[model samples]
Target: MGWMRRAKVARDDPDSTGATNTVNEHQINNEGQRSNINSLPNELLLLVFYDAIQSHDNCSAVLAVTCRRWRNIVIHEPKFWGSILLGSCHPLGKYRLWTMRIGTHSPPRRISLIIRGGPSVYIEPEWIQLFDALKARTYTIQSFHFHGNSESLSWANLRMGGFLCEEIYLHLDDRLSMNSSISAALSEPTWPTPYPPPLENSISPKILSFRQA
Candidate 1:
């Protein structure tokens, strides 16, 4: 009887010990996961946040409000504010914020405004307002590329004031196809005078295209 009882005790001991070991292993794994999450650097975290924001505007705005650190990083990042690629669904308000948020650094060197899909109603006044605002700034904007329905093109605004742009490319739908529109807009008579010719011997054009966009 003594030997039989000892055998039963030995068998129960292994089962109890195995259960404890399993619990311990689980706890260790949880702790390790927490530690790895905490170890990620702030820069890495910021990049993760940027990726999250790029896909959806609502998410971006929400993330921007997550904390002061996130807000500051997103606001100061030049890429966030410099150039905006617009699609057919125009979010004018967002564009306004994007433009306003740009750093004091001169306007972006390249501006690509693409409007795709079938033609939409063209509201001349809003386009005029936006173009006028662009003209009012003193900074030299190098290029403006537009792609979309020709009728939607705001020719009046594009032709307004002096745009310090070196190269302007307009790709339009078949309806308003006219290469002359590009020339006419660039040839506005009242265009602002370009900055004084570079000192008698400047090697670069007042504005040069460093890269093709």
Candidate 2:
């Protein structure tokens, strides 16, 4: 009878062990929620950061400066630095930094660079700098897009030295047809061989030409 009464008390009293267990469980859950972000597993952290980056192209640069951990992640990961677009809006000061970051990849990954130019675009120097800076990286240029004036025709030839690019897009102004030297260069056996520039606009043609090698 005594043993039976003791068992009944234990079962019926919720304040004895049940309440303590519930409180402990709640505390455990709260601690988990308050855990430090840096305490997260490296793999999971990488996935979270990569998701942010893939969602927005510029997020790669943004996330790199958030904290030391994220910066390290961006620096070590080659995929983040694989593609570079130097448009008219991008600041020229950051170009060297961007190229250097991409240069860190071993056997360097395939890269795509788009250089936006206009009539007075002085991108020949930019191209020379990029080519020189990336030489040691041994980077493989997959595609290069240039948009600028006819004056660049002669100077831009420097970009073709060691470029094993798969595709090249040159959006040069129509004056290229008038200059005999530029016209002759474009007619060479290896130059614009397969892809011919469109002749739609005769006066000041904006030639959106492409060559696949």
Residues 67-115, candidate 2, lDDT per residue (tens digit)? 7887888778767765555554443445566766766554323333444
Clashing residue pairs in candidate 2 (N, C-alpha, C atoms within 3 angstroms): none
Query: What's the true lDDT of residue 82 in model 1?
Result: 43
Best by TM-score: 1
lDDT for model 2 comes to 0.52
Which parts of model 1 have CA positions greater than 4 angstroms off?
A: 1-40, 44-71, 87-91, 116-121, 151-159, 175-213
Question: What are the lDDT scores of the predictions, listed in order?
Answer: 0.51, 0.52
Estimate TM-scores for all models: 0.44, 0.44
Candidate 1: tens digits of C-alpha lDDT, residues 1-213: 654555556567876665555556766897898678547777886678667655543454455676676677777765554445554444455557666677565544555565544323245445545566665765665555556544434542343353355555555554433333333343322221322222222122222211111
TM-score for candidate 2, please give it.
0.44
